[model samples]
Target: MKKSFNGNNVEICAPAGSWESLSAAIRASADSVYFGVEKLNMRARASENFTAGDMAKISRICRKSGVKPYLALNTIIYDSDIPEMKRICDSAKSAGISAIIASDIAAIEYASSINMPVHLSVQANVSNIEAVRFFAKFADVIILARELSLGQISGIVRAIEKEKIIGPSGKPVRIELFAHGALCVSISGKCYMSLAAYDTSANRGDCYQPCRRRYIVKDEETGFEMAIDNQYVMSPKDLCTIRILDKILDAGVSVLKIEGRGRAPDYVSSVTGAYKKAAGLWNKGRFSISAAKKLEVGLESVFNRGFWHGGYYLGDKAGEWSGISGSAATLKKIHIGEILNYFHKAGIAEINLSAGGLETGDEILITGHTTGARKMKIGSLRIEGKSAVRALKGQVATFPTDFKTRKNDKVYLLVPSS
Candidate 1:
């Protein structure tokens, strides 16, 4: 698929922790989706990692949606892990994964053996043009280190183009950067705090997030201990570049990636949807400050960690991290109703309207384990078997839908901003 920017194609890669997230990303207009394999992916514990069978299913779903699926083999590996790695590579190849993001050299070699397109993971920390040039020999795409500033990224891209360093595809190595999501206090893939605190390697997909924990300061000579001024001193606020997206685009990156695989389908939808719209406007030179503020508000409405900043992309001017709580202050989503039953042939779904009643003409998103966020307007609503304009908070309502809704699926009313 050709991902376009402005009039040119550029990818808007979204995270897929589950099938619901995958569907949400696609519906939100993500150009591509990235997910992890079971057991060996960086988000193995955080996400519902795909099994071999699940990979084939994912491939079909992505293909049907016209979105490319990239496998995340981007985790530390051991010598004994090669066999499982190769098996995964073979499976991903058969499943038609667009590429495999790998951090370990052995994992890269194994993926290369299967002729899968390799993307150097952010774990590799490709900061300089020299590193980009070196990886160009093997990797089709390079996910630049998160610590890089726009100036640094621009220089690297220029140097690569000037040097004519070609990737496996006989074209310049594609640059992908994290445009939104959680920011790690430690450098990407270089942290040993998790290892020291939990005896689990962060690189091996087993981080216990020691950085998000409170710590006490101690003076060894006096043998005195004092609580830190702020508890979550290590955690940084989440990254939100909606305000300076055009500057990021000028840095010559091909893909803008959102970083939330452990997040819900709603999160994936809201974040990706906002960025997708903003990037399109930016490309067309139609983006404005008012539009950016609106987009920022929409992003915060989904989930956030207090506030946002440009992160390392703005260099030291990005300012001090404000997230002292080491946790996301996600907004509480309003509940409209929950699915009770569905009369499939009748194209009607019975919902127990418990909170915030729904009115006719209101926009809603239906989400569940199997029901990937389906968005539609309430054309009609019935309460207690009677045609009604609205369903009260305590009423059991039924509504006609174009898609089948499963039991337990949640209905969220999308209220227009005043």
Candidate 2:
């Protein structure tokens, strides 16, 4: 049955939080990236958003690395925020942003006025053909709501094909889908809990993540309230679509978006690289259960908030909406070395290599009480002030560090989850 499927022209889109994550995405072979400029994007509150002056640099870097950069302006806009929004839109146009992911009608109109391409954000709640037809007038692409099933997505694709909505390039409009990442407890990420809790609207990019907090369930009529104990009733499991890549592609989605702008570089590289390989396998008509499991292990190793599920892709099953009873962290790291000495002035830390060897481009995770868990790659490795590619098992290796480390901070080599 898989032999009948085709995966040609499918694009893998990743998230970029900073230059480190951006470079990691490119190295992992992501075809494109979606990022925020400042506080205008939904993930801006949790991410280190770029400044306006960094727009041109972002465009140049992505283009040079053979990747496309899409500016995300998906937050709601108020009347008082019009001028600044217009300025950002104008800067996006000048920076050659591939497309603007927007939810506001004003943003759509601004993109149209500036002759910039637009993509309808999922925040638009586009579930039916009517909504698609309406947004088709302003957007070249419409990201479907996350609540749709595979059959429903196929139906929407068929319906749009009949509408004859041409894209900005005069071709048929494209459909993009969220293939992986965190799932929202609310209906398509339109939640009011944050506003109710702290008067900060999530749609306005000031969310406080009230959903991840502990809560007590209560019955008003009986006046009874009790704690669930170790369970987050409102937290949904992260989404993983590796097992259903063929089905999604068969539904006519040309772009697959991986959601994570607030994650570490290792997370970006691991997830994006796994999907890139998975999509390639599907295109070759060789996708199998073992291949999917391998990809799943890689995903679990980097991060798994509550675990993974098919999410809405599995449809309205009885337990599809239930939350998890605690998060699970997998993927044990291999002990490599321990901190020996530090040259704080030079931003370098010396490690007494013991177990595993160190090589350039190898990712290392440093952990301590004060240092926490910081992940970085070996951009430069030295042995006694001389450049070295691979530090042997007993050699003292020196690598650059960004944060202050304690005397006994441990270093571990990160690998795919076993």
Candidate 3:
């Protein structure tokens, strides 16, 4: 891992929407995991958020695995949300949460009053050194505005050190950057398109993502309408920095955050693992162009709206808009079936094929709440004690495996995209 100016290794923070994604992040060697609980977070409507009751368990899991857990309470807070916010913060503090990622002043002030560590969320749109110094009074870490350039970020980092600005922890404030994930066309993701259209405020955690859809431009005077040409104009491509990760590390960032709390467990696992490997390679001066390309291929196999560096980091003003309405991942998952039983001693898993069939040499992914995400290839298969090359739908098949899979774990076959 790349070390920041403070000599601490840069942290890789992954996102978790569910227990499965949390486990997957840990399995992929994430330094920390951030997640939403209840409706007080930005991904509240997009993900299966944990309840306040789940805080202890989540903290315990992360503690046992040596991964820090950050509770995201960064949505726009209303007066009615004060009680719930306080309850959640109390729960997090009691549960030993590492930190709270917050944007609203209400959440930040309450968290500070309770003496709990806080990390400024991107919603705060902190862009300048003065903003960092101000937030440093309440937070130990600050995620800079996504619109800032590398030169700007470097300047802020330098100012933090030169100005001797320290956080509530009495240590130098850490800077975090969004290393990879979906990019919003809005400035620092503070858009009100959802609220303007559907009465659902994106700031309140219920984003209707009107930007991801196709739109038609209509002439109000002439009643002439024309569809935009093959582009989701408002939706920018997903941000990918693996190619320029060394430059990011050189900027003295203390944390690399992967944003996907609403995505699948496998997506978390794949992206976190890729960044982890890339960071390690970078520290050893082995992050060559070929290595980055290989890691990028692994990334493209997962969920993405097409990859772009974004003008924010490179200082290009033009937008890299998404051409498609959804993911342009190179590989897609096909639901095959679920595991019926696992014969531990025999190292075999009995599966009931409910949908698609599986053939030898086919790669399969097994995902579950406890199992997380596990991928393996089918070397051989058996059906009713007879050796078989393929297991069709409705057939009970047994396959040898190295890892243990739990009952009801969904299985998927990875296939090439059309």
Q: Which candidate number would show the highest TM-score if scored against the true structure?
A: 3
Relative to the true structure, candidate 3 reaches a TM of 0.98
Q: What's the lDDT of the predicted structure labeled candidate 2? A: 0.80
Clashing pairs in 3: none
Tens digits of lDDT, candidate 3, 1-418: 4578777887999999998899889999999999999999999899999998999999999999999999999999999999999999999999999999999999999999999999999999998997997899999999988888899999999998898899999899999999999988898857999999999989988999999998778899999998666557898899999988888888889899999999999999999999999899988777777888889988999999998863478887747888888899988999999999999999999999999899999999999988888889999999999999999999999999999999999999999998
Q: Point to the candidate with the largest lDDT.
A: 3
Give the RMSD in angstroms, all C-alphas superposed, for model 1.
3.7
Q: Candidates ranked by TM-score, best first?
A: 3, 1, 2
lDDT of 1 by residue, 1-418 (tens): 2233222466799999988899889888998999997888888878887787788888888889899999999888888888899999999999898999998888898788778999999999999988888888789789998899999988887787777788988877788999999878888889888889779888888888777666778899998998655766776778888888888877778889999999888889888999999888877778777898888876876656755567888885443565455334334556877999999799999989878788899878789766777777899988778899987898898889998899999888765433
Poorly placed runs, candidate 2 (over 4 Å): 1-8, 218-224, 227-230, 317-327, 332-418
Cα lDDT tens digits, model 2, 1-418, are: 2321122377899998776577768878899999998888988787888987888988998899789999999998988888988999999999988889999999989988899999999999888888887888888888999888888888888776766666665666778899888777888758888999999888877788887766787899997987665456677777888888878887888789999888766678888998988888877888776898888876877756744566786685423322544334465567888888788898889998888888998888876533545678889899988999989888998988886665677788876554
TM-score of candidate 2 versus the correct structure, residues matched by position: 0.80
TM-score of 1: 0.88
Q: TM-score of each candidate?
A: 0.88, 0.80, 0.98
Reference-based lDDT, residue 316, model 2: 58
State the displacement of the C-alpha of residue 339, model 2, in Å, after optimal TM-score superposition: 12
